[model samples]
Structures are given as C-alpha cells and as structure tokens.
Target: MLIRLLYASRAAEAVTHELIESILSESRSRNPALGITGILCYGADIYMQVLEGSREAVNKLYNEITCDARHRDVTVLHYEEICERRFAGWTMGQVNLAKINPSLLLKYSERPVLDPYAVSGLASVALLEELIATASIVCRP
Candidate 1:
C-alpha cells in the first residue's frame, strides 16, 4: 500500500543554503531508488516535509529522519494510506518559504511565517498544493 507522511521539525542550528542544497542532492540521488517522492519546505528555522511511497519505505525514511542530527523536535503531523501521490513527479521538491508571499502564508498560519507546528496537517498539505500550483519551487533531475 502507498502512504504519505508529513512531519515538522526545528533545525538544530542555523540552516544555510549550502546545507539545504546538500540535503536535496542526497535526497534526489537516494529517493528514486527507494520509490519515494516528497516536498521539503524550510524557513524560520523550521522544516515541514511530506513523504509518499510504500509503507515500508516511508516509515523507514521517517525513522531515519527522526534520528538525523540536523533535526530537533521532529513531530509527525500526518501519516495515512493514500490512493495517489501528491508529489508524484518530484523525488524531492524544495521550497524556501522565505520567498513565498506573506499573504499566502497567512492563509495557513497566523504569523505569516513558516511555522508548520502551528498549522494542521490538512492545512499544510493545502499550502503545498498552492505552492506547487504557483510553480514556486520545482525539483529538477
């Protein structure tokens, strides 16, 4: 069965552009072989990610992420079997939330910031859908 997992975590330290690129580089290289697809959003020292794949793969990946040194206070926002992949084409799409419009952020967040911890899982998914539709961020192979 296919499953989708959403989680939010605080960066253990300041996250830089190079660090983000490195993470994406590794994800793009590893995810395809594992049959995983997802979107990663980062800003304000917070990260909100959605992973979709087989139950085994998604669970394994989430477990590994929980142990990663780069993340702290990792909280699973949502996890469920899904009939379709929301991020099917991207092994790991990325969005720098700082670049998105403040008004858009206000739709899902009260602070007009990227605080996934304060947003519901469904709202997080909706925010991602909006981002994708706007072509705000794209992952290229």
Candidate 2:
C-alpha cells in the first residue's frame, strides 16, 4: 500500500537549496531500495510536500521530515492506499516555494496564525486540481 502525506511549513522562502538537497539526499540514501518519491511546493508563506512510497517507507520518511528543523506546523493530508500515483516520475522531486500556486496557498491559509482548514488539507485536493489547471493554462502561449 502507498501512503500520501501532505505537510505545510511555517516558512515561505526558508526552504533553501541546501535544505532541499539535504532532504533529497537523506530520502535517497536512507531508503535506497524502497523507490520513494515526492513533490514539494512553496507558496508565499507556506511549504507543502507530497510523499509516496510503501507504507513503512512513507511513514519513516514522514517521521524523519517531522524531526527536521527546516519545517514547522506539519499536517498530514489524505493518506490511503492507491493503485496509481500522482508523482511517480521522479525520485524526490522538489519545487521551490516560489513556483507553487499563490491562490492555492491563499486558499490554504490567510496567514500563518490564521489558517483555515478549507485550504490545504483533504479538501485542498480540489484546490490543488484547480491550481494545476490554472497553472497549465497560464503556462500556455
């Protein structure tokens, strides 16, 4: 079974290259055989990441990430078994906080101290789909 965890970071631009590199390296090095994969997004003041793998591997990865200093205010979203993967194309794929959809972030939180559950949680998947579609439209010439 595959597990999916959605986490939000308290810092917006706090996710540095060094931090990303460290996460990627650790994820790959720690589970060289599990074939884990993920994607990261950063909005104005939050960081969201999706991790997928075997149940044990994904849980372990989540534990490691929670202990890391680079993140704060972590939240899990939509964890369940799936026959298909939304991010199976890369090994630890990470996108900087700047590339994420601002509207999605806005939907997720009005501000750090004022987070509304409707933005980036289980219900946020709908927002994510909307953002992706909007992004795809914007990227077109």
Candidate 3:
C-alpha cells in the first residue's frame, strides 16, 4: 500500500541556500527511482517534509533521514496509508518559507511562522496543501 509520512526536523546548523539546493538536487535524482514524491518546506532552521511512496520505501527513507547528521530532533508528524499522492507531479517539491506570503503562514499559525512541531499533523498537511494552492511557484524543484 502507499503511505504518506510527514516529519519535522531542526537543521543541525544554519542551512545555506547552496546546501538546500544540493539537498533538492539529490532528492530529485533519487526519489523517482524509489517511487517517492514529496514536498519539503524549509524555514527558521526547520524542515517540514511530506514523503509519499510505498510503505517500505517511505519507512526506509524516514530512517535514513533520522540518522542524517544534518537533521536533529526529527519527529514524525503523520503517517498513514493514502489512496493518492498529494505531490505526485513533483519528485521533490520545495518551498522556502522566507519567500512565502505571511498571510499564508498566518492561516496555519498565530505567529506567521513555520513551526510544525507545535501544530497537529492534520494542520501541517493542510498548511502544505494551502501552500500548493496559493503558491505553486514555491513547489517546483
């Protein structure tokens, strides 16, 4: 069965644009081969990612991510069998929160920030869906 796993993690340190680009490049190159499609949102030194794929692939990837040195305090926000992929078109969609509209952020949180750790998994997913609807530009690789 297919599954969608959402997780949040803090960057080990300040992440540079170059680093983010490299991460996206690697994901773009690798995810398709594993049947993975997802959206990765980065802001305020935190990452909120939604990965959709076969259960095994998603679980394996989540394990690898938790062990990666770049991430710390990794926390799974959501995981469940899904009938369809929310990010099917993109191998690895990306959003830099700094570029998103504050109004969009305000819809999800009181402080207009990307703090997935403080939000429910359903809310996190809804926030991502809103981002896709309002700012498709940010979802491109």
Candidate 4:
C-alpha cells in the first residue's frame, strides 16, 4: 500500500544552506530507489517534509528522521494511505519558506512564518499545495 507522511521538526542546530543542501543531496540520492517522492519546506529552525511511498519505505524513513541527530521535537503532522501522490514530479522537491510571500503564509497560519507545529496537518498540506501552485518548489528530475 502507498502512504503519505507529513512531519515537522526543529533543527538541532542553527539551520544553514549547507545543512539543507546536505539533507536534500541525501534525500535525492536515496529516495527514488525506494519509490519515495516528496517536498521539503524549511525556514528558521523548522522543517516540514512530506514523504510518499510504500508503507514500508515511508515508515522506515520517518523512523530514521525521528531518531536523527540533526532534528528534535519530531512531530508527525499527518499520515494516511493515499490513492495517488500529491508530489509525484520530484525525487525530493524543496521550498525555502523564507522566500515565500508573507501574504501567502498568513493565509495559512496565524503569522507570516511557516510554523507547521502550530497549525493543523490539513493546513500545512494546504500550504504545500499552494506552494506547488505558485511554482515555489524546485527539484531535480
């Protein structure tokens, strides 16, 4: 069965471009073979990632993240079997939440920052959809 897992966590250390790049590099290299696809949204010290794939693969990845030293307060925002992937185009798409328009962020959350931990999973998913609609994500084919 296929599943989609949405989760959020705080960076254990200050977030940097290099750190994000390292994570994306690892994800892109590892995910496609596992039949996984998803988008990663990041800003400040927060991370929100969506992983879609077989139940086994997705679950394993989530578990790894939960135990990863780079993250803390790893909270699952959503998880469900899905008929199809909302993010099928990229191995691991990315969106820098800092670059997103403040107005768009405000539309989803109480403030202009993307705080997945403070909002419902549905709202976070909606924000991701909006990011896709606005061509905010960048990824490799």
The better-scoring model by TM-score among 1 and 2 is: 1
Give the 10-residue window scoring lowest on summed lDDT in candidate 4. Answer: 132-141
lDDT of 2 by residue, 1-141 (tens): 876666665652465667657666775565447767666555445566667788888888788877767667777766777787666654555544355445655655664322423464765555445544554212100
* Candidate whose lDDT is highest: 4
How do all models score by TM-score? 0.97, 0.67, 0.95, 0.98
- Model 2 pairs whose backbones collide: 42-97, 107-119, 108-119
Candidate 3: segments with Cα more than 4 A from true spot: 137-141
Clashes of 2: 3
Preferred candidate (lDDT higher): 3 or 4: 4
Lowest lDDT block of 10, candidate 3: 132-141
Give per-residue lDDT, candidate 4, residue 3. Answer: 95
Clashes of each: 0, 3, 0, 0
**For candidate 1, lDDT tens digit of each residue in 1-141?**
999999999999889998899889999999999999999999889999999999999999999999999999999988889999989989999999988999999998888998888879888888988998899877878
Score each candidate by Cα lDDT.
0.92, 0.59, 0.89, 0.94
**Model 3 steric clash total:** 0
TM-score of 2: 0.67
lDDT of 3 at 139: 42
Global CA lDDT computed for model 1 = 0.92
